[model samples]
Target: MLDWTTVLVIVLMAASTYATRVVGFVVLRDRTLSPRMQAIMQNVPGCVLISVIAPAFVSSRPADLLGLAVTLAAAMRLSLLPTVVIGVVATGLLRHFVG
Candidate 1:
């Protein structure tokens, strides 16, 4: 059932993403970022996450909408890490059960 090309693409994409993150740390290893820059960097990941997830909100799919509702509820009560885990698990479950 596995498509080798799709699997290769996914592996390459994951490797590139990991490399960029690692490179960022290596490049910044000797430099001290300004407070403002640090704050901006801190929010970059959250902003990226929002950009990725925002389009799904427009999809009008029940599973996505309900998963978002669950994620939002989790976010209100949990920290960012747990919220992300909950959101991912909730979305997968919703998709399986509702679709």
Candidate 2:
């Protein structure tokens, strides 16, 4: 039931994503990272996390905002699993009762 253009687009997207990941690995395989490069790499995870979280927090509704707040507090306390649990439960409960 799929059209040719749609299928081609999907295939190209998958291939592009795969190629990007593979290229990163190939490019870094034999390289010794300099101090600046190492520092950049060290910040990558935090940067990626902030990029994902920032938009969600900014665009979320009040209930989701509450859940995000709870999650952030738990995360600050270094309780990752509890943060995730609280976020999920708070969001689910709010959506169920309010929305």
Candidate 3:
């Protein structure tokens, strides 16, 4: 069942992604970002997270929408780690029980 070619491609993709991150750090090591740009960089991860889950907002599945609601509520009141944990658990339970 294991495809060696697919595995190789995945490994290469992972390596390339990691390489890019390292390269970016190495290139910017001596440079200081402007305060505004630093603030923007800090929000990039959250923006990426929202973009990833944006489709769930319009999903027809009750589990998806409810999970997103629970995630939003958790995000509002909790720190990132706890919010992520609560969201994952809530979504998994909702999907398993409701689907």
Best by TM-score: 1
Against the reference, the lDDT scores of all candidates come to: 0.88, 0.74, 0.88
Residues 1-99, candidate 1, lDDT per residue (tens digit)? 999999999999999999999999999999999999999999887787677668778877899999888888887898778888898999999999998
Worst 10 residues of 1 by lDDT: 47-56
Candidate 2 displacement at residue 45 in angstroms: 2.6
Quality of model 1 by C-alpha lDDT: 0.88
Error of 1 at 1 (Å): 3.1
How far residue 16's Cα lies from its native spot in candidate 3, in Å, is 4.7
lDDT of each residue in 18-45, candidate 2, tens digit only: 9987998899989999999989977775
Q: After superposition, how far is residue 94 of candidate 1 from its true place, in Å?
A: 1.1
Error of 3 at 38 (Å): 0.5
**lDDT, candidate 2, residue 72?**
77
- Model 3 scores worst on lDDT over the 10 consecutive residues at 44-53
Q: Write the per-residue lDDT of candidate 3 for residues 1-99, one digit (tens) a residue.
A: 999999999999999989988997898899999999899978876886788678998899999889999999999998777877887889899999997
Output the lDDT of residue 92, model 3. Answer: 91
